[model samples]
Target: MKWEKLGLVCTADRFGVDVPTRVMVPTPVFVNEDTIRVFVTVCDKDNIGRPYYVDVDARDPRKVLRLSERPVMDVGTAPSFDEHGVVVAQVLKTRDGKLQMYYSGFERFRDVRYKIFTGLATSSNNGESFQRVKTTPILGGSDYESTFRCAPFVIEFEDRFSMWYVAGSSWETIRGKQVPRYSLKYLESPDGIEWPVEGRSCMELQHDEHGFGRPWIEIDEHGTYHLYYSIRVCSLAAYRLGYATSEDGLNWVRKDAEMGLEPTPGSFDSNGLSYSAIIEAHGSTYCFYNGNDFGREGFAVSKLIK
Candidate 1:
């Protein structure tokens, strides 16, 4: 597949919102025929992130319609799972006509830099407001995934829900800095809420790659699966997009050379890009993603040309 790059769309500091730092992750969900709300996480001076959104025109996604005045849900109270920050990952509409958001809850620690786990929230008024189902994360520390379990993306089928998330148990020091080492994993749930204690490894780090960021899964009409994710390469010291395919969701074959999106020289994404989310509307397919410094300049879009 090929994509035509569209420039930066929304930054945290652009619209005069309270947050003044990064706009991480552009998770878009169709609000209507004309409106696609891209949910993101905006950070403050302390680097505490909360979920916000920017509404864009579906046909012309670069055209901004509105922005969220406040966070959909605030971070959890002190000593809670999400006390440090909350990054929105994926949002899906439930069978009961409510919206369910899967997010990575952040918490800082002295021994480790931080721990991230999956949290869930529900919205009934079309995402204007959200309330956490619980103060604790639904996908927290388990025997197998004791350290980190985050960046959850779920697709529901007729009988069950399939999830693709990043999980790891250890941190590694690379280039004299401590960083988390994780890879893409998969799980299934009868309901969108309860999941297994462990996930099956779908993709592991290869060669110079040390970690995997968010994983996005797309299913074609013929039932072929396409996976888009970010790989942290040791040589480059940055995140780059990788692609894969699967006959069954559990087993994947890497196809990195085929992921046509590349960083533009001297652009906001000159260093690298990550956290990609794909959506289709009005006969067009789009990939929304973050750029250098983890989207300090917000997110951008690319339209699929092939």
Candidate 2:
């Protein structure tokens, strides 16, 4: 779809980070009638990953009022896995009034390439404090899988919970060497615990000479589902976001410029922007996406002019 640029509402500046160096992926949420909360992955000067929460009053959306006193979550426990780092993703408020977080965990070890997994955490006090689910590592290695799972986006559909995550072969071939080039896959859970990947696991979008992966999807109130994903334009040595739509949440159709909301130039996002988290508010749509080579998170607003 072709999206008309409507200026940036928030930039990396809000976190005191310099472009091309620091990176931040923000997941926004409407906490209440008066508050908006953004959960971000904050890296220290030493590049250690930590979780930070920034809150703003819905009344004055421009002013950030509170930041967490300490990293709400971080790497803990060792040898088992996920001992190296952890990063936060979109937080969801369950039907039972509990807050659930879907996050990625990274572990390091010799003889093993790397391990990435999805974990679940819950909060009872409206997100102030959280406890990891007892049945942890909710999503991990398949019997024949390797490498890891990362960048999970989850949402409730109808009465079921669904997630789209980046998955790839544990092996890769690069310049006379082999490595893993991760791609995206889809899974669903009835209760957000035991997830089973769909038969059609990967996106079938035509590639742009490089490859494609990292999908973020959203279903609007009207039941229309939209997916925004990243694809590398090898000739340009850059990544770009592409759009597709599905009414049944399975088969999808790529929309062209003639359809509306095509890519635009200018702004911090002109270079590379993908992994878009989209939400609709006050009758308009806002997309929060990583910008400029996935080094920082920025937002762009569009009126869904289609």
Indicate which candidate wins on lDDT: 1
Q: What is the C-alpha RMSD of each candidate to the true structure, in Å?
A: 1.2, 4.0
CA deviation > 4 Å runs, candidate 1:
15-19
Task: Enumerate residue pairs that collide in model 1.
Answer: none
**Residue 135 of model 1: what lDDT?**
80
lDDT of each: 0.90, 0.62
TM-score of each: 0.97, 0.79
Please report, as a residue range, the 10-residue window in candidate 1 with the lowest summed lDDT. 11-20
Best by TM-score: 1
lDDT of 2 by residue, 164-245 (tens): 7766545544444444455556777788877863324656535533345456677767988777766655545556667778
lDDT of 2: 0.62
Which digits, one per residue and each the tens of the lDDT, describe model 1 over residues 1-306? 899998899877864556578898889998888999999999888898899989999998999999988899999999988999999999988777889999999999999999999999999998998998878888999989988999999998889999999999899888888899898888999988898999999888898988998888899988889998899998888999989999888889999989989899999999989988889989999999999988988899999999
Model 2 bad stretches (over 4 Å)? 1-21, 57-63, 110-113, 134-136, 157-159, 171-180, 197-199, 208-214, 256-267, 296-306
Model 1 misses residue 139 by how many Å?
0.8
